[model samples]
Target: MFCLPVAGIGASAYRGWPTRTGDIEICPIQLPGRENRFRAPAHTSMDAFVKDAADALQPYLDKPFGFFGHCFGARLSYGLSVELAARGGPLPQRIFASSCLAPHRGGYFGGGRSGPFTPETTDEEYMEELRHGCELRGEPTPPDELLGLSIQVLRADIALTCGYRPPGPGGTPLNVTTISWTGDTHMRPEEMDEWSAYGDVHQVLLTGDDFTHRSAPADLLQVIADGLPERTGVLTP
Candidate 1:
């Protein structure tokens, strides 16, 4: 499975995940402007990002694979799948969307808010918000220098999310598994039912807080293992 990180963070977030979870191999995608890709400019357009990501993933598309994304990453997973299908490229067998509302819900942030912050938002405000978010996730805030860089990447990511427009009415549907954490305050499990519009959504509720996914618990792995096939096979062109 390809693991996409949450907003404002890097692929390193999944560093704790075992290299292989059951029959699934964990592959974490590294978006630009964060971690090792810090020098690369962050993408502010969903279409552009998806196109580039599809191109970059060509070699790995030979075998059956799936996507696992949390929060903003969830949106990217869905977008990539749609884009690949449009291009007649290989598609994922399943999509694991955790802690995110369906695209048609029409809101970047929870509670139908268009966006939480804008380019006009002051650095101090962004810092405070980031700190608060870390607190909520039970993690320590990054140092000032790192936080400053994170803010830049986050701003670009937020712009990408805000600018995205979901498909109208009936969009293409795929096999998807929507995951919700019992303690997730950001996106409640009950609010994610709209995902059914996108595909055969199998709703899964895990017992943990929002950041629990970072730990890659047994239950979460088991859920993922259950959704995937026991053997990997090549995708027919």
Candidate 2:
């Protein structure tokens, strides 16, 4: 499984993920401007994100593999899959999109931006969000660990998410599985239907399960395993 990182999550997020590197390998898609790889500025657009991500992950495309992405990462996986197909390369055998709604759902989350954030907010708000700090009252405070780590990468990612107005409709010519919290605030149950545009869409509802796949490793493993036949028959070494 090629694990794509969610917004504010780095490749290191998969560290000690309760599994071995043989049966399944999690390749955390390292976006530019994140984690230890941070040295350059970040892009605020989806297209730019795809271009940079594809380039960075080019070396890993030596074989076909299952792609897994949650929330922001899900969008990246779809984009990467499409881009590779467009370029006549080894396409992804299966794409697991989690936590996010359909790409074409305009007005998602009450539509439009929620107005500007206070300037008091850090320049990199995405980084600030994942800060391991406990909130006292409603104000955000950064923890020592987060402060020590470079967060500009996360901030840039939020800028991209905020600025995005998903273009066109959802339709990827690839096999896909959609997983979401049945009661998730961000994803609507109806939105899962939109995934049919991508061909062979399987929707998994974690009715009471939390966001973390670790919450149900057995189930996640089954989904990954079910994908193998399609992958084995279709994807080359």
Candidate 3:
């Protein structure tokens, strides 16, 4: 499975996950402008990023693979899947979209706010939002410097998300599995049912708060394992 991180986070967010679960090998994609790629510029255009990502991920498509994306990463994963399909490239066996609204759903709602956070949003506003999310997840807030960098990346990412508009009427569909947490106040489980519009969707309701997916608990891992094929060998990139 290729794990895609949520907004304002890097692939390191998935470091705690087991490298191999059952017959699946976890591969977390590291986006530019974060973690080890801090010097690189973050992508601000979803279309451009998807196009480039489709090309870059070509080598890794040799074997059967799937995608696991949380929150904003769900949208990114969907975009990449669509792009790859358009290019007649390999497609994921399945997509696990966690804590994310469907593409047709415009804007975002989180931290008691609706609509995407614009570039006009002040630094303090972004920090307060981030702090609130961490507090809700019962996690420690990052240091000032780290928080600052996250805010920078978040601004660009949110722009990409906000600028994105789903295709009209009959958009491309994929094999989607939507996972919703009962305790996730940010994105209600009922709202995620819209994912059915995209493809054959299997809705899963887990018992945990919003950030529970970050921990990679047994139940979550089991859910993922059940969704994948029983093939052996390491899936890369």
Candidate 4:
């Protein structure tokens, strides 16, 4: 199984979760341009970024596995599911997508997924948007090794976020079970409901202090493990 991190943080955020949850093996997928990979080239478009993640995990697709993504990571997971389907491969047994609404649920803010990054946006202005965005819900700040990389990644991600236009009010159509986190300022409740139209729905509402990532990683994993399709079985799908 794969546990993807939120935007600024890497797979290191899942340190609170078990390496193996019941029958599922947990492997947190790392985003490029963060952690030890700070020096790698960054991706500016959501499509390209998700493709990179799918490519990185292609070697491990020998069997069915669960996938989890948070915030921007969640956005990529949805796209990855679509790509995997297009390839006629074994899809995720379940997809835990948190902190982000289904792609088309909320109307596109910036431009929908069509154009390139915007210019005339200074780095400082971009950083302020991140600060406000992060403050809206709990998300991790960059560590020293990743501080600069985080800024770069967020800027690139914002370009995608600004340009993201969804398929419609309908959610993705992957067969995997879909999990969503509520109380996220980034994604509203009605938007979350749109996710149910996609597949099996499991909503985890994190109100109060738990609304943010720092206060909710453990709870997040628990939700994923407990809500998994099956703890033990033949593992055939």
Whole-model Cα lDDT of every candidate shown, in order = 0.84, 0.61, 0.83, 0.60
Deviation in Å, model 2, residue 195 alpha carbon: 1.3
lDDT by residue (tens digit), candidate 3, 1-237: 888888879998897798988788898989998999989999998898897787788887888888999988998998898888888868888999999888877554432246435557899999888888788777898888989999999988888887787672257778889999988877889878778888778999999977888889898999888888645567565
In TM-score terms, which candidate is top? Answer: 3
Candidate that scores best on lDDT: 1
| Prediction 4 global C-alpha lDDT | 0.60
For lDDT, candidate 1 versus 4, the one ahead is 1
Clashing pairs in 2: none
- The TM-score between candidate 3 and the true structure equals 0.92
| Per-model TM-score versus the true fold | 0.91, 0.74, 0.92, 0.72
**Candidate 1, superposed: residue stretches over 4 Å from native:** 114-121, 136-138, 233-237
Candidates 1 and 2: which is better by lDDT?
1
Question: Over 4 Å off in model 4, which ranges?
Answer: 105-122, 125-146, 164-172, 175-188, 207-219, 230-237
Clash pairs detected, candidate 3: none
- lDDT of model 1 at residue 167? 82
Q: Which tens-of-lDDT digit does each residue in 1-237 have in candidate 1?
A: 889888889999998798887667888899999999999999998998999999989888988898999989999998898899899968888899998888865546643464446656788988998888788867888898988999898889878877888683357778889999998776788888888877678999999988899989999999888888744853322
Superior candidate under TM-score, 2 versus 3 = 3
Looking at model 3, report the run of 10 residues with the lowest lDDT sum: 107-116
**Model 2, clash count?**
0
lDDT tens per residue, model 4, 1-237:
677666556677777666665577778776677777767766667677667777777777776677777656666677777777767765776777665566664323222432212344566665665566556555664344444556677666666655555554344455433444454444554545556767766666655332345444666657666766554432322
Residue 135's C-alpha lDDT in candidate 4?
60
